[model samples]
Target chain A: MTSGTTISGRPGISAEEFGYLAGGPGRAAEVAVVRLLEGGLLRISREGVVSAVASGAAGAGTPLEAYALGAARTGRMLGDLVKSTATSEAASALRQHLVDRGLVVSDARRKTWSTVRVLCFVAFFAAIALTIVFRVHFGVAIGVAVVALLLRWFAGRMRRPVRRAGRREVGRVKVAAGDRVGMVAQMGLLGRVGQFPRMYYVWEMLGIVPSAGATLRRRKPVRNSGDTGTMYGSSCNSCSSCSSGCGADNSGCGSGSSCGSSGDSGSSCSSGSSCGSSCGGGGGD
Target chain B: MGVLDKLGVGIGWRPEIDLTVERLPGVDFVEVVAENLHVEHLPESILLLRERGVPVLPHAVSLSLGSADPVEPDRVEHLGAVAEALGAPLVSDHVCFVRAGGLDSGHLMPVPRTRDALDVLVANVKTAQANLPVPLALENIAALLEWPDGELTEGQFLAELVERTDCHLLIDVANLHANALNLGTDPNRFLDEIPLERLAYVHVAGGVEHNGVYHDTHAHAVRPEVLELLGELRSRVDPPGVLLERDDNYPSDTELAGELAAIRGVLARHA
Candidate 1:
């Protein structure tokens, strides 16, 4: 049978029960599941498998119910399903329903703190205005502002993610130190002079350690034949470790040396179009 | 083709920094990220670069050419189509696997430097090469970690791959530096073994170090040492071209132009 088709006594579960199983079993999911189970739309199997009660002939259920049923029939584990986006949505909606109904306990301390925070911010602004206009003590104003910020920070410490409702917050993937540094560098924060100097030096400036910091200078201008210098040179000759044929013998195909810088006339190999014919259409390895 | 004749200096073309790219003076060519471009609707800035006769190389990042699984037909086809669409001189991808066993690692994974892995890479590269509209240049990638029992060095593996498959090498100097620092491989030894004649071009990008590991980040300023490495490679053989890659935290036009100028200055020094 299709997962949607209800058999007799298949444990009366609703969208809520399915959601609870699919979603995480935190207080939000738990409270929501209980409220919906009480509403008579949900049923629980003896095996604890949750499904929706047969509403009519075909046993059609809500999208959330069908999703949960399909997941269960496929033998999906609760641990796996909890991470799915569909489960998270169902759980969030159910949690919101419970919150609206006053079924779950709300945090009184958080609510009171939030109210106090708003008053504190208003007073803080007023203090700044007084300092600016009436020549109030600047240090006292600064102290008050610092104390207000600290109070808010402490209040924020008592907050719990599950206690809040609305948009579902998926946890961030832990970033590696290298990736984090790279990201900061990419954001132009590291590039700005004197910002994050230690980070900039350790990460961005670490490259200087290898090169021995030899300053580069422009070479003497040669005739524009594209023959800037001999392809093979004595540059590698100075190294005593140069064993793998790096010195004097690595001259490339000497075709491009005769070409002038003014045009592509003396060049032996055509750049893009020539390769298109060779590489495009067909070729064998 | 003589890569040096037309190429004086080039910058990697990213959509976010198109304005700065367009303003670069004496830019001989630009490397486009192949996966980002659709054959049907390529970005206008890239088209404009083509119109200006700046050679655009299709640098593919997702080919996973080192995977044990057969290279996907669609991916190869897409790259072929992009090469054709851009009229590219050559196409390039890393000689690293980004996925294995039907799961994507999301970043380039170092291939085990064993004969078996080499054989897999050879077959895959050959398959990809046959389908590509231009010659394929496989780049050496930066490995965050390496196999404990790797049978060959990075240079040996790449040289063998090039010898076996007749593909070109998109030698990323920064990657070589990163590998040398992080994995304890010899960079000069790497340069020594590789066939410099088959250089499709060169890639120079910015990177950083975190903790004790050096990262090829491509988001920061090019280090002087990287330029020194480029110069060292030049001392070995004259490359036809070199392209600068900057993937994020794009600097202002003035800063980018200055960096390009710095690259030009280095190339001139080596030339």
Candidate 2:
């Protein structure tokens, strides 16, 4: 009574029938029966009556006979194909293998590796975002993560890893605002030239530090850290709102690349990397 | 030790618990749902227990902090106000996303593990934290499906948020078990992997069976598997005090007593 369970009378009631009963809408008693059959707790005879199925036995009939008798359909099949010895945990893993291949539906049961992997990913990214917020270098953050993951992966191979799948996603960035950078200068003769307003029409700029419509003084640029007073922040990459989301006023500064000084490819830069994709992700810390 | 106060081991607040109200075992703490606070919810048909010494915790649902756009800042602000009024140590909300960019998933949809998403959670957490006096502790939700782009586990992601933001962890033991059951992972390993230092609270709730799937529907009594895992957590991780959650089927006080007794039994083994 390995993977296929056979029922005597109802010759075609596969464990799939038990799968439906175990999963489908049914009375508590009926569900219990389905569970018993599915769990290999019972076998059915030709009369359609149920009987206990021994847990320690090998296949007692044809695969279809095993199916009809309500044997463990998943167990023998996996045992034969993969390896001789398989624990319930291992069996569950094989079950997941089928689901992954789309042979079986996966919405019902949880898997340890998938759960652990997903949760670990969720926690890792969360930590990374926090690290980014603390201004930790992306390299260092990923480095630390790699070391930890390697340790865990190696450790799991040595010991039985508690496997589980968790589906949750969070990404964010925290950029320091409220800082000012460039100074304004009209394109006229040095120091305003004692002229009235509108004397210097060529005064285009970036980051008006002193006041409104001010021109920025050109300065040398460095990578990553703030050079021009604008602090960079990063979080869950998918932030929905920005202090000044895409709008008409974006023509000057906020539009980043579309302003034409930078390429549109480089336009959507935010707290961290170049932006331009849909920036809606986190709750915005 | 006893220095760690008990979390919400509230009256079962369900009829199943009611069955054994008179013979129910005693619990150390209790929590009343926000919906059941007023007479309109509890009604005169049910009498509130008179226990001044017992701690009462209030949990809220449907606060969509993960919504992309601002829906009602007032709603969030109001919930903060209530948690404050009640002197709750930590206000809890689900990590599931309810709406995005003004469109409703109509379910508690989870986001993918991208940097952009982390940013959103941090922003939302910050907003909620600023409004409330108490730190916000988010609970892990059970998801029937997953986003394709995820690169991390829910535990790792939650732990990271706690480590970075100083946010408290509300470890839901039942959710853990349900995840273990639904996702086919080793419960023992998951409990061990989570960063336990940030645990501020914990949850245990019963689940439902649908189409051979065990769902964290909060309908049944706290499953024994959940209790066993809680005990394991106590031994391995020194988790926060436990809370027994009975969301559906109003149970009698005595029935809740039994659930509490079961918890205490698990606790005694851990102790």
Among all candidates shown, the one with the greatest lDDT: 1
Interface RMSD of 1: 25.6
Off by over 4 Å in 1: A1-285, B2-6
Candidate 2 Cα misplacement greater than 4 A, ranges: A1-285, B1-8, B11-25, B35-51, B103-106
Question: How would you encode candidate 2's per-residue C-alpha lDDT over B49-77 as one tens digit per residue?
Answer: 32234444455555665566543566566
Write down the TM-score of every candidate: 0.49, 0.43
- Please give, for residues A1-285, the per-residue lDDT of candidate 2 as tens digits: 233332222233333222211111111112223334334444322112234343313433323223322333322221121111111232334334434543333433213333454455565676688686898887788876776566544332221110111001001111113100001100110012123664331112221112112211111111222111011111101122222221111222233333223222343433212221211110000
User: What is the Cα-based lDDT of residue A170 in candidate 1?
Assistant: 12
lDDT string for model 1 (A1-285, tens) is: 111211121233232322221111221122232222233333332223233232211222433443443443322222232223123555445434434543321335435654665666776787798899998999988888878766654443322112222112111112134332222111111111134453332213323111111111111212221121110111111122011111111111112222123112322111210111111001000
In order, the B-chain TM-scores come to 0.97, 0.82
Chain A TM-score, candidate 2? 0.20
Distance from true location, Cα of A260 in model 1, Å: 66
